[model samples]
Target: MDMLFSLMSPQVFLLSCMVALLAGVIKGMVGFAMPMILISGLSSLISPELALAGLILPTVLTNGWQALRQGHAAAWGSVKRFRVFLLVGLVALLISAQLVRVIPHWVMLLLIGGPVSVFSIIQLLGWQFRLPERGHGWVEAGIGGFAGFLGGMSGVWGPPTVLYLTALDTAKTEQMRIQGVIYGLGAVALFGAHIGSGVVRAETLPFSVALLVPALAGTWLGFQIQDRIDQVAFKKATLLILLIAALNLVRRALIG
Candidate 1:
């Protein structure tokens, strides 16, 4: 508790709690965006290094909750189905996390921003493509690598994973499960990777653990609200938020 509270000022600490709560609500509703929200929101108020560490524990714990929410059988099924993607993605995440400790902050922002903006715009513009069935395995590997690299560097890999799954025409139920499985394992990989990279050291780990409460609590609350939303409207709203966030990332990168 002392170590966690020592990581930030009272004002900044309250802001982080709000950020975690909002990010949790969005994730609970849409099944993605917690890291993006946390990293992006916190970056302004704190060093990105500390913010990166702060997101780790909550992300890992919450993703684990999501993966097992439907029970072991469903979770395992999704894992088996996307085994290639998970394997490639997690490996890439582990390797690339090492790079994060060396890279400049602005460069990381460009990486996160560039892909997010392009993808969000593409998704909103309704461009469509279908992969030849047999070649999709390789495509999945590629997507996983890209997602993992992004995940390692920016603490976000959702956009590419979502695009790949969306392109594969995965049904709604399976898509969520697939996302949960991918993110859960990636979170595990991230925890391990960062431990060695010093992103999960004692000072940072406490702050991360402290935020888990708001993150998880707000997620549960958001799940209750998810059932009340219209799918079409909610999707448009989500995209708008992504676009805004993506642009903000770019702006930050440029100004720095």
Candidate 2:
């Protein structure tokens, strides 16, 4: 309790928990964006490093839940199918994860905010990004590397991953499962990477752990809504909200 309070006041801590819950709910409904939401929201209340730390364990656990929701075999199949992306992404993530320790906060925010805003705007424009029907190995590796670089630094790689999946015209269910598998693995890499980077150390770890309950609960609620709602409608709305949040991040990066 003493350690947690040192990070934030009681009211601020409660707000951070709300952010986690909101992030989880969005993740459940759309199959991605939890890290974006967590980072964008929590960074408002705490230092980016602490916010990053706060998200680490919840990201790992929630993505694990998402990946295994369909069972191990399906998750393994996704791993096999996207092996190139996974391998490249993990390597890039490992390399770039170290940057967080030295990168300026505003630069980090801009890096996250810029790409996310573009992604959200492009998605909102109804432009269906497409790829050829043939070999995608090189493309996979490229986007994977980029996503991993961002993920390592900011705990965000969803925009590019979603774009790649969208380009493939992947099925909704398969896309969701693949997202779970990919992000789950990425989150695990992030966990290990940040641990080595000293972002997820003793003082910050408990706050991350404390957030798990609300995250889980909100994800469960989102799952229920996901089953019944018009997903396209819901996704569009979510993107709009993301656009707002993303632009706010950009604003902070530039002016604040």
Candidate 3:
């Protein structure tokens, strides 16, 4: 508590609480929006690196629970299907951790946001797209590399992963479960990578814990509202949010 207070101003604390709450709700509902929401909201007040650090543990905990919630059968299935991708991505994330300080934040934002935005727009328009048939290993590896690097730098990996999953036409329940698993794996990898690289220091722990309460609260609220929303409306809302987040990333990159 004292450490949390020391690291954040009253206003920043309050704002972080609100953002966490909202992020939690989104996560509970969508199983994937928390990082995007939190990073997008917190980046204005905190350095991007700190914001990324603060989310590391909480995201790991939440997503680990989410991934395994559906029982071992489903979880294992997802793991088998995406194991190679996951392994490659995790390794890439570990490598990216080393470069966190060397790489400019804007460069990461541009790398992640530009392709993500373009892909999201293409997806929203109902275009039929597919990954290349040849060099499947290389293609998956490349996506994983980019996702892991950006995830380490910006704490946002969902765009690439989500796009791939969506393209696979995964069922809603399966999609959620897969997302949970991917996030869990990514979070665990991030914890090790960041800690090894000195990004997850003692000072960041208190703030991460402080943010958890609001995140849980928001998640509960989002669950309550999720069932009330229709599918079309949900997709539209999600797309809008993605576009806004992408724009925000682009703006941040350009300005900073």
Candidate 4:
């Protein structure tokens, strides 16, 4: 708590809690967008470095929980199914993550915001892309690589991953489980990559740890809401909200 208090003022702490809570609920209901929400929301209130650091623990926690929601056997099944995508994404994420320390902040924001906006809009427009079965291998690799680069730079890989899955026309149940697996594994890679890159340092660790409570609580509450809502409507609304967040990120980068 002392470490948390030292890293930012009380106002910022409250902001972080709210951001984490919102991100968590979306993630639990939708199985994506948590990191995007966290990064997009937090960057406006704090430095990108601190924002990334502060999200590490929360991301790891939420993903792990989401991934295991269907039980360990199902999670492991997803891991096996998407093994190549996971490995390539993890490797790319680890390598590109170090760039965070070098790349300009505006560029990072665009990296997070641009793809998110474009991809979400594409989905909203009812576009369903299809890859030939023969091309699935390279396509998966490509998507994973792009997602890894985005994740490394801004701690967000959900948009591209979601688009890829939807393009495959994966069933809703499996899509949710797969998303959990990919996100959980990505979160693990995020924790490790940032720790090595020095984004998740001693001074920043406390902030991340403190966010775990709100993150889990919000996710649990979101699951309750998910059961009663019209999923199609909720999804459309979520995409609209994400679009706004993405535009906000772009605006911040441009104005700054």
Candidates' C-alpha lDDT:
0.81, 0.85, 0.77, 0.82
* Tens-digit per-residue lDDT, 122-222, candidate 1: 87898755555455788889989999998998788877787676666565556666777888788888888989898889889878887899999988887
Ten contiguous residues with the weakest lDDT in model 4: 127-136
Ranking by lDDT: 2, 4, 1, 3
Regarding TM-score, does 3 or 4 come out ahead? Answer: 4
Which residue pairs clash within candidate 1? none
| Alpha-carbon runs more than 4 Å astray in model 4 | 132-135, 234-238
Residue range 18-45, candidate 4, lDDT tens digits: 9999988887777777777788778879
- Residue 127 local lDDT, model 1: 73
Q: Model 2, residue 166: what's the lDDT? A: 69
lDDT (Cα, 0-100) at 216 in candidate 4? 91
**Residue 189 CA error for candidate 3 (Å)?**
1.1
Best by lDDT: 2
Per-model TM-score on C-alpha atoms: 0.92, 0.93, 0.90, 0.92
Off by over 4 Å in 3: 131-137, 227-237
Q: What is the TM-score of candidate 3?
A: 0.90
lDDT of 2 by residue, 17-101 (tens): 9999998888888778888888888988898899999988888888888888889999999999999999999999999999987
